[model samples]
Target: MSGKSSWPELVGVMATAAATQIGHDRPDVAVEVLPPGAPLTPDYNDHRVRVFINLSAVVIQTPVIG
Candidate 1:
């Protein structure tokens, strides 16, 4: 079976932990932590996971492989 492709549980988790978990789950993908309101490129990359966090460094958006 395939590994985790999405992280809904990490929504309220810390940004660092979320990133670490994503990295551990999908080692091939690059994990990028984005601050709230940050500009995101329209381009899509299968090898990337964007972790959107709030000012307190807490994940506000569910991280998912793109």
Candidate 2:
């Protein structure tokens, strides 16, 4: 009996967990301010941010064969 949730819920949970971990690990990372009317670029988005984190040794892993 697996206690798995839906995809969106799982994503939310994982994001929350990562944020908690980051906060615990490094509390000095400041939130950057974006200028108003800034173009919505994928390069400046959360997914890109996550990718950067992963590449920079922030290690985000997902379960395999779940």
Candidate 3:
């Protein structure tokens, strides 16, 4: 929510996950149900489920000697 925090583009994430599961041909309907910080419950579409995966990771980098 904070500008300083690099919160990922949530809507896009959901949309993409939706598309991945259901295929790109599916309409962009899931986004309407997906409000900011809304819970992607089991009842929700498969696409929404995939989007949740984006948060299932942690990115780390090793320090460079430069």
Candidate 4:
């Protein structure tokens, strides 16, 4: 990922990956994940600015398999 990328883009990437994983097991299932909030300080590195966005995206995109 590039530094100029937006938070939403990062989130979308994660979502896509999660969706792919879900599709692997349940091809008929559809996943719709959403971000909770901005990324926290610990979620991103010091060189990143939109860490909150990325973090939030990751949280939202994470799959909950049971």
Best by TM-score: 1
On residues 1-66, what C-alpha lDDT tens digit does candidate 1 reach at each position? 357889999999999888888888899899999997799999988889999999999999889888
Model 3: how far residue 18 lies from native, Å: 7.4
Best by lDDT: 1
Name model 3 segments beyond 4 Å from true: 1-23, 31-38, 44-50, 55-66
> Could you tell me how far off, in angstroms, the CA of residue 27 lies in candidate 2 after the best superposition?
0.5
Model 1 ranges with Cα > 4 A deviation: none
User: Model 4: which residue pairs collide?
Assistant: 39-52
Clashes of each: 0, 0, 1, 1
What lDDT does each candidate get? 0.89, 0.31, 0.31, 0.39
Candidate 4 per-residue lDDT over residues 4-61, each given as its tens digit: 2223333345555645554554544434444455333344333323222144355333
Residue 31, candidate 4: alpha-carbon lDDT: 46
lDDT of 3 by residue, 7-64 (tens): 2333344444433433333333232223335464445343322323334322122111
Candidate 4 accuracy as TM-score: 0.37
Candidate 4: worst-modelled 10 consecutive residues by lDDT = 44-53
Q: List the residue pairs that clash in candidate 1.
A: none
Which residues of candidate 2, in runs, are more than 4 Å off?
A: 1-13, 31-66
- Scored by lDDT, model 1 comes in at 0.89
> Which RMSD values do the candidates have, in order?
1.6, 13.1, 15.1, 11.8
Q: In model 2, where is the ten-residue run with the lowest total lDDT?
A: 1-10
Worst 10 residues of 3 by lDDT: 57-66
